[model samples]
Target: MTRGTTNPNRLRRVDRWMAWALGDLLRRSESAPVVVDLGYGASPVTVLELAGRLRAVREDVRLVGVEIDPERVARGEAVADPPRVEFALGGFEVPVPDGARPSVVRAFNVLRQYAEEDTPGAWARVVGRLAAGGVLVDGTCDEIGRLATWVDVWAAGSGTSRAGVGPGRGGVGPANAPVPHSLTLSWRLAGLETPSVIAERLPKVLIHRNVPGEGVHALMNALDRAWAVQAPLASYGARQRFVATARSLRDEGWPVLHGPARWRLGEISVAWEAVAPR
Candidate 1:
């Protein structure tokens, strides 16, 4: 019942990241898990795009795009390739064939309508559907996919907490409650401005926390400062400026997770603690 406002390649940023970040997991799944694209909107292009990108990483990758609306599901099924890219009707249930759990449940923009406090329960539901070593990516993005952010959630001992980020250190919720392993920010660097623009599109949990006196707010401010100070590198292109800004944030005690390799792609990941709400 979520708004299905989607378009072709709208999720290209995250999909590209997945191809590199979780490609290995998909390759090693051994037929145990499927990749689910939850709530693919009115269009199935993104779903088709997901299959294309993921298949390049794992030729035999099993992929499914799920939506609570049966109409959308039917639409997706029309153009899907059988046995590989498929569509299903599901909500947070994250249904898969033969009761198979998913290795990665990518629920983007599906929870934007829910209350912030509802995130934990909804997240737990999605994570519960994950197979061993599974990951749930709860995220949001702009319509055209220019700016985006997502939180990576994993089961205990899955060792899926990656991109150089780990729990605690301010990333994990107090009392050791389940929290995001890493927070990722991505953008189309050409015609880019300051990095703080991503604050508007952060995952639901941190979206409202971008105001003054909030941890996420402070983090965005710091990034803006760093991005400004690194203006000299703009001559080399936004990529270099972004890489320098990332290094600056790290040097300032921010637990930035990804390195220049990712930063150069207009992406930066951070341990959740570095900006988790106080």
Candidate 2:
């Protein structure tokens, strides 16, 4: 059995990130989106809590808690809400009844124990099950869900155009247009020692690639240096120091995502290229 260590409100950070990043998608969907809380551990509290938060955005959101262990699934069923939220027995295959495909799958802290080589197969299994224009959030976080990182996967052959499209293609033609793909790396920065320390808990895909020559390694090193340069701001507090450090990195072309709003929360996100394996 997998370690089922979990706590109430432990996944708040990741949940909040989801709301901010995917809220538009949730609100725009014509039909209610089905969400899978994959591998929700021992208790169903996290699934229950996630349903509450997601429903705040979309009143019609449906949630399903899946566990590989049948006993765990039974336990989840015992605690789950009847229709809006349910429980099932399954692994990465993400078995769904009525031949339904989920719009979103939040698989947090599920693949940390697997061999690195097995990650792609596992990711493919879940991503393949997502509906068109759907998303698969594959991630790992601390037991309490304070620090988290996830990759948002989209189905192939989905919408290529972004929200806003300007007339007259200046930079590149349709064929040369860069594919719309991204990986978001989020960190809770309370006294973060080195970005590489996160390697210990990385979702199986990138854990072993945190070596010296990898893209993740370079990004972490850059973060460490930026943090060191902002040591003077530490007198204000770690939060302020983190914000300043992030701004510095951004000015230096680090692909930092947002401004003080996200920074104040001790979080930073960069494009997948920032940490993709070399």
Candidate 3:
């Protein structure tokens, strides 16, 4: 087990993003949608918070916090409400009751301790346990949640295209491998510097790839340039500056997703192709 380090609301940004971006998936589930908070750490607060937020999207949504450490699972069990919120003991081979597949798996800061080369295999194993149309949010963030980056991964299937770069030194994995659809970078925006500050917090696949000749490097450079160009808007607020930055990136042919509403929240999501590791 890696360090179970955590803090209250430390994951609020990603939780908010998921509830907004994946609300439809939860609502459309025929059965109560299942969401897994993989490696919830020592406190149950984050998973509990996730349950509260997601229940707004679908009241019947189920939450399962999985950890390899039984002590942590016991800690989660201490506060869990059975059938609604619960904890399980498992690793990348996600084990759910009755073989229930999860609609979404939020694995934040879990892979930080793992070898980069093991990422694709771990992703494949976890994505294989996902319900159809499900997604795996593999992310990394700072201790207080100031800066964050994540990849939206999907299992290979019909309609799935080779979207982003693969894990480790590989470009893209096999056609049948799990693929990333997009990359999301988020910030607190309170004391933000250049957008490239997030490079250090990028998900495992892109972290080491943030160097010369890489798409992620180019993306960070472009983001820093855009942030500088919009520096004047900081007087209005960092939100305004960030929105302008997003717009600038979009104007420059970057496949930035979402609009001002999300941008105003210090979030910018782009198609994986735009920032995929070269």
Candidate 4:
């Protein structure tokens, strides 16, 4: 179990991104899509916050906050509104009501507590529980969530897999490993520093891999360089500076996804191959 450290609005960045990125998935569901918040900690505030944000995407979206600790589950149950927002006592098995398959399983700040080598197994287990076309968002953010990075993992045959990638490069692994699709970085631009600082908040699979000769390391270096190149834009605003930085990376072929629309919000996403472990 995690230390259960959390704060109000600590996950607003990722929550906003998920609401936008997965809007179609949520809206097109034949039934009210199920969304799971695996390992929501001591407080259910974030879970409640997530439920509120997702309702903007689909009013009937169901939320299930899963935790291994019974006490945490009990805490969540206290505030949970049955059917709309609920809590379950479980681990990566991801138990949900009525055996409903979740369309998105968010395991943020959860896997960082485990050994790096154990990441793939945990990912596979969570992804296994997702509904078809579902996505697993594995992420880590600072206490206040000013800095955050997450990788989007998809299940095999989910039709969400990136094209032209082979095993271990955002593709399948030796066993029933999840297919990582992309990496996204988000920052609160009000008082930001170097983009490389996000390296400290990388998700578990790529955290220790942030060294020389690794893809993630190279991406960090490139982002830092781009940030420098776009430094002049800072005089206009941090948003302008960040958008320019993202444009620079894309201009140099970093496989950066999204456009200035997202970058303007102090965010950028890149295909996982751009930063997959070497």
Candidate 5:
């Protein structure tokens, strides 16, 4: 059984990120986009909440909450409304009906309990069920959905390639560079001692690799040093210090991805390579 910890708006951070990053795809799809909230724990709140948020961008957004545990699935089913959202029993395979493929599959915090070696196959299984232009968002976050990081997976023929690649065979660019789509660090600004503290809650894939010599280790070390150096800026507030610290890191060539929009929220993302395990 998966950890059943979940809350009403606990996944807001990831939900917001998805709306922004995948809005275009939803808008361009021929029909209501199908989205699966794989392994939504304990409650159906997150799945329901996701449907509400995504519907703001595309009124036709459909959501299905899948849980491997029959009891959890039954619980979700009791609350899931028709058309807008539903629940079922399934695992990483993402069993959809009628040969249907989802436009988006969000598996958040679901893989954190699995062995590290299982991630690649798990990713492949879910990604294989994505529609031609669909996406698979694999991520992990805290109970309140803060301090999140997710990788956006595109289908093989989805017209998008990994980041840094040149135009494809037809000279068309990838839908969106397949970089670790986004990494959001949501910390309590006033008490944040070091960025490395987040390692404790990282997805299973990188949690064990937070030791010395790992890329994530190096990145966090640089962040801590940068934060310390920017101590003077804290006089303004932790937010200012964080922004300044982030800017300094960017100046140092860290590939910090988002701007003030994300930083103001106590979040920042860099290329996956910046923090991938060495």
Candidate 6:
């Protein structure tokens, strides 16, 4: 288990991405969509914040805060409102009441503690419990949530797997692979220095892979170059500089996603294949 260290609003960058960038996913969910905060650490404040932010999109969204630590579960319980939000004892299993799967699982700062080889397994466990059109967002971030990144993973298919965990009735198909869609980077603009700072918090699968000859390394190097080339834009503020750099990434065929609207918020996302380890 982690140190259970957590602070209020230590996840704003990601939250904004989920609420706004991923709103389409939520909109597609049933009247009462469900979201899972897989490992919210010692506090439940972030969970509460998630409910508040998401309510703006899916008003009837349900939220669950899963924790392996019984004590942490108790902490979440103290603040939970049944039928809408609840706390439970679970690890990567991602157990939810009534055998229902989650539409979105945000397991930030959860897999870094395990061996790199274990990342795919952890992902499988979570993705196995996804609802239709669900997305498993596994990621890592700094203590105060300034710099953050995540991979949007979609489930692989139909059939039963993971100890009684089978796909929903008429689910996609039988499978056991995670199809990652994109890699997103976010930063708190105030103290921003260089975009490469996020290399320190890359997911387990890509963290060590960010070395010479790796696709991720090349991506970072490309980003740094674009950032440098856009130096004169700094006079307009870091936002403009970041937007120009992101534009360069897209122009160079780096497959960058999103646009200036998001870049202005100190965020940019790229297709996963563009940087997946070779």
TM-score of model 1 (CA atoms): 0.92
TM-score of each: 0.92, 0.87, 0.92, 0.94, 0.88, 0.91
Q: TM-score winner between 1 and 4, please give it.
A: 4
Listed per candidate, the RMSD to the true structure in angstroms reads 2.8, 4.4, 4.0, 2.9, 3.7, 5.2
Worst 10 residues of 3 by lDDT: 160-169
What overall lDDT, based on C-alpha atoms, would model 4 receive against the true structure?
0.87
Model 3 alpha-carbon drift over 4 Å, by segment: 158-176
Clashing pairs in 5: none
Residue 237 in candidate 2 has what lDDT?
A: 84
Cα lDDT listed for each candidate: 0.81, 0.73, 0.85, 0.87, 0.75, 0.82
Query: Over all chains combined, what TM-score does candidate 6 have?
Result: 0.91
- The residue pairs that clash in candidate 2, if any, are none
Candidate 3 local Cα displacement, residue 196, angstroms? 1.1
**What is the lDDT for 53 in model 6?**
91
Q: What tens digits encode model 5's per-residue C-alpha lDDT throughout 1-278?
A: 67888877888877887787677777778977889999998888889999999998899888899898898889888887777787878988787655468888999888888899998778777866777667778778777754676666554446443332212233223333232433445565767777667777776767787788887777778889999999998879889999987898899999787687777677777766577656
Give lDDT tens digits, candidate 3, residues 140-199.
Answer: 899988898899887665233222222322425554367787899999899888889898
| Position 169, candidate 6: lDDT | 37
Worst 10 residues of 1 by lDDT: 168-177
lDDT, candidate 5, equals 0.75
- Kindly list the per-residue Cα lDDT of model 2 for residues 1-278, writing each as its tens digit: 46887788888877887777666666767777788899988888888998999988898888899898887888888877756889988888897756578877898888778887777677667877876556677778877765677766555544422321111233222322222244445566766765556656665677778788887667677878888899888889888888898898899998777578888887777766677666
The most accurate candidate by TM-score is: 4
- Alpha-carbon deviation at 213 in model 4, angstroms: 0.5
Predicted structure with the largest lDDT when compared to the true one: 4
Per-residue lDDT for 79-133 in model 1, tens only? 8886788888888988876677888889899888889988988887887778766
Candidate 4 versus truth, CA RMSD in Å, comes to 2.9
